[model samples]
Target: MNKKYLQNFYNQYKVFDFLHTIRQCGIISFWIFLSVLFTTSSSLLVQEYPGKVRQYTHTIEFDYVNWTFDAFWQKFLQSSIRLEDYLPEKQPSGIVREYLRSVRQISQLESQINVIYADPKITDKVAAAKSYQLQLDQFNAYKKQLAPYAESTLQSQISTILSENGLTLIGQPIPPVLYHSTPLPMALIVSPRNKIQQDANISLLADMTAGDMAALEDEVMKNLNVSALVVPIGGVGIYPTMVMSTSDLSFLAETVAHEWTHNFLTLRPLGINYETNSDLRTINETTASIVGTEIGKQVLKRYYPDLLPPESEISTQDTTSDTSNPQATEPEPFNFRREMHTTRVQVDKLLAENKIDAAETYMEQRRQFFWDNGYMIRRLNQAYFAFYGAYADTPGGAAGTDPVGPMVRALRKQSSSLAAFLNQISMVTSFDQLTRMVDNPPAG
Candidate 1:
């Protein structure tokens, strides 16, 4: 892509972010032509679709009040340890390992509890509830043991991985910590009724109803210590958030590393302007995707070898493998990556030619084909692609054709080691830098 085209793409995102910010912050009403300010009058949205269009106008009934210091104190006071008690650690201790195991148990029990509660046939609800509560109580006792060490343990691992990979930790008195956030469902806004545009997204707390809110609430709220534009974040670099309760340790490790990369890159230009530039956003995501996966694999190899993907599965590079143990029952072979890649290329071409109806039809057919192959994808529309297409480093889904992904992957191949690869890529501040570096190699 030419510099002008890249600039145009970035400008589109910048416009959306600016307008969307006004909408989300409940300030658009104060401006003239509220509808025009909030939404584009593009004729594409009004065009006919094969299915009924569900129009969603963003609104903000009430401004979200962030939890104050008193709220933090209240939660902290509930814990046995003080916030300052967790000293920076070089490695995770036995307590960290035990805490993680307990967390896994709790997650499993909680999932079972949900299933039992949902089952209509279970007549002895009270008895089952009591039994589950007892088990939960046993696990919950570890919260005291967990509080002080959880963040430090995760931070240590992230720091060690980055250090090993030849990247310096940015300006911070201590390694970044991880706090488990409440899982929130992020709202994705797409244009053309069903087509996913690169811009237009707002993430409120997952519990907030998009139906009730006008066009304003659906806008991505930008404020202190929050970037609602980034979705499905298991971990965050700023203010250090992590999904500590995930039963899947490998995924948890990946998220820990992923968020750390964001923190590490924040001082660099690429991450600093991540939201404003679409290609930079993709580069950031794809970079983190690659680094995070490698870090996850490294963590498993060193600490939890049993959690590593089996040789058979690793050879195939099918991420959906059972990494927990070497099981007797062989996993049924399914290559969703290759199929999804093909789907993306085909869908992109259709959308490029302005064949919206044909594109939607093709997506549905492809979705069914995937389902028959043991992948259940519910509602594979433009929004699905829009959200998933960003991670181009991974071959699956809508990221197949993204030139940045291939360039980064090529850089990895040319580098002599993991550290060298990361060091070279970390210096990249722009899309052009990536292209130039990939095209020309430095003397060894």
Candidate 2:
């Protein structure tokens, strides 16, 4: 929001905008060509497994092509307007703050509306809903008006941090730090009953109700003989990344950076082989998680220091110790990571011994325990672990006893800087290579 920062941004925007325009043109042309080629060859390339999955989900699946086209067009229009350039100095930050506030208000209104509709005592439900709907409409319109500028402001902030951290090409982040926060589609994860591996992950319609999701999962499981769970995600790694709408600035920043990191890796070997095996997928996700959190923190430190978590909150140690009454210590807080790590380890052991039914029953019991302790996990099964387990950014969670995560963390520890870590890991194509790299550190 500084005057000098705004001026510099305006100056850089012009050059970067021109370059992006040219680059996007070529990319669009290439995609158009591919569309034509794929349309002709689509029938021949359909695989048996995915084809069968599609047969069950074809009616309810999300239309990514149409969504991407609309999103790209909206971004193209936003770029043309150059909303941030026209904003008064110091207004950009305020715009983002107001946008998030508006989102929170909207969320509150939605909750009120839901309560009104759900209350059986409210005889005039329609009338009650109308009052909240009018307020919701106003906030929605205000959010829509402010969205472009807010997005542009955040993008610039993130891009600046990324550039400073040495994640740049020709002084700019490739793909240009673009993201659009909206309602995100739920992913239906499928895995074999005997193992905890994600065999298929399909995107479903965003507006599907919980009952609808359950029904679909049931159908998939019954027909495919696989474990299935529909999970809501924070973001997707498509170009112009799709992020979930949220009022939490920290979460917003981290998710934006996370998806952007995915885009960054897509051009390199590690990302290219993301789907080659479970290890690579874990590597890709863990790497993105690390970069995203660090960059998100930097963005907050520079732009919104007040939002940063206090040192006490960030620290893991219980510094508020009462040494005088050490014998009368309170019960330790429920550690989700440690508990989840235990669950994953036990589940792995059960599945390894081919005790599929027992593993599932155990997961259900664990799910109930988590739910009782305020973690509302709808379903806990092989597919749930298969999907959530890939993000091994931090130690001892759903990753269980997996060595890949620790190896990646070790590599991060060995590298001199964040950029150095990314550069070395981005070129890795397999888990064996990652193991070798971790085992044999570079001589100083």
Candidate 3:
């Protein structure tokens, strides 16, 4: 929060933001006009080092507020629902439905095009550009054919599940899916450098280049002294609640339900006081993870039964056994959950012991250990754990010794059904509420 450092950080972040805005919105002329306006209005007189005041004619606040994604959503909402072209007999047959088939084709094509566009090997720039446009056009045409049907079917399933579970907050219909993928891998900035502190939240995310993320993270960390993590987010649910068009059908359905859960919690105390209380933030994320997974499975079962694992096998694969030993599994193939859990707990222990440098070294050592075991993690720092350690809905590995995830899971176990679990968790606003609600809990 240092003013001088923030000023330096803002300059770097703003340029990336503007570039991302152009990429996502495709409003080149509009951005060009705005850029020219900002340039003309602002002038750089002198560059000063730390403790010196460097002034600008016009100061622009660098925040995620710039990324409305409004134009994209508005276009999607208007066009995605008017699917009067395809007849019922023309659609595909069986559990692998038409919408799923069409969406998979679109998603794969979109991903391929994105990869092509990012590739630097093409010597014929003009030819490559033309090909990109053609592919994009084809992708859009395909999307237009089935996006509405897909979105409507998915939303209907989500709504039915929510209603059945007594989650009536989503009774009113909302335009919840985007017809096309925006871009890949958005960067988010969380502040204060302390993993446990959650107040005064701020994040900047854009579907920009992966290379840009390293530079951006360094700027945020060295200059602004904040925690930054760039995630390949499947879906984002800020307001309108959107699923990335290119996501696999199963993942797409799950993400849609996941994001909607975020939207649903936004009206409650857990969401309202999200930043003010770190534990509440954990509770909120854990709740979403739990509900989203359950709802996603239900959607798969209803629409794409083939995607759903057999109920008999679910206990073996997905569900953690109530009385299962932690040491029961073979030590091969790198258990990420157990390893990540160890990292979180140890990192906290070191940080608590006033060993800052030791904590960092510990993380790097752990990162190398993971790499040695065939898990290539790019970075392992406080910032990384600070962002990812929130979701504690499911137990083991990531949950580590974090009381929130376990407490939430325990509450779910005590409940009669998924709906009852969600209903009880929704009523919880703080860690204290979780403690009071659960029985035979871990002693503080």
Clashes of each: 9, 0, 2
* CA lDDT of each prediction against the hidden true structure: 0.57, 0.83, 0.57
Over 4 Å off in model 2, which ranges?
1-49, 317-328
* Residue 259, model 1: Cα distance from true site in angstroms: 0.8
Q: What TM-score would every model get versus the actual structure?
A: 0.68, 0.89, 0.70
Off by over 4 Å in 3: 1-136, 169-185, 191-205, 310-331, 372-374, 440-444
Which pairs of residues have clashing backbones in candidate 1? 57-214, 57-215, 58-214, 58-215, 58-216, 59-214, 59-215, 59-216, 59-217
User: Arrange candidates by TM-score, highest first: which order?
Assistant: 2, 3, 1
For candidate 3, lDDT tens digit of each residue in 34-75? 333322222110121112111110122222223334534454
Which pairs, if any, clash in model 2?
none
lDDT of 2 at 339: 82
TM-score comparison, 1 vs 3, better candidate? 3
Q: Which wins on lDDT, candidate 1 or candidate 2?
A: 2
| Predicted candidate 1 versus true structure: per-residue lDDT over 1-444, tens digit per residue | 124533444455443466656653443232113223212211122232212122332232111113222223333332322222333232344545676778778888888898888889998876878888788888887654564455545555566666665555363312233344335334443434234445544333444443433333234222111111223435434323334356567888887777666655655667666665567777888888888888878877866777787888666764434446766577666677767878888888888888877987998999899889888775566656666777776555577577777788788888887667766776777889899998889987
- Which of the numbered candidates is closest to the native, going by highest TM-score? 2
Model 3 worst lDDT window (10 residues): 49-58
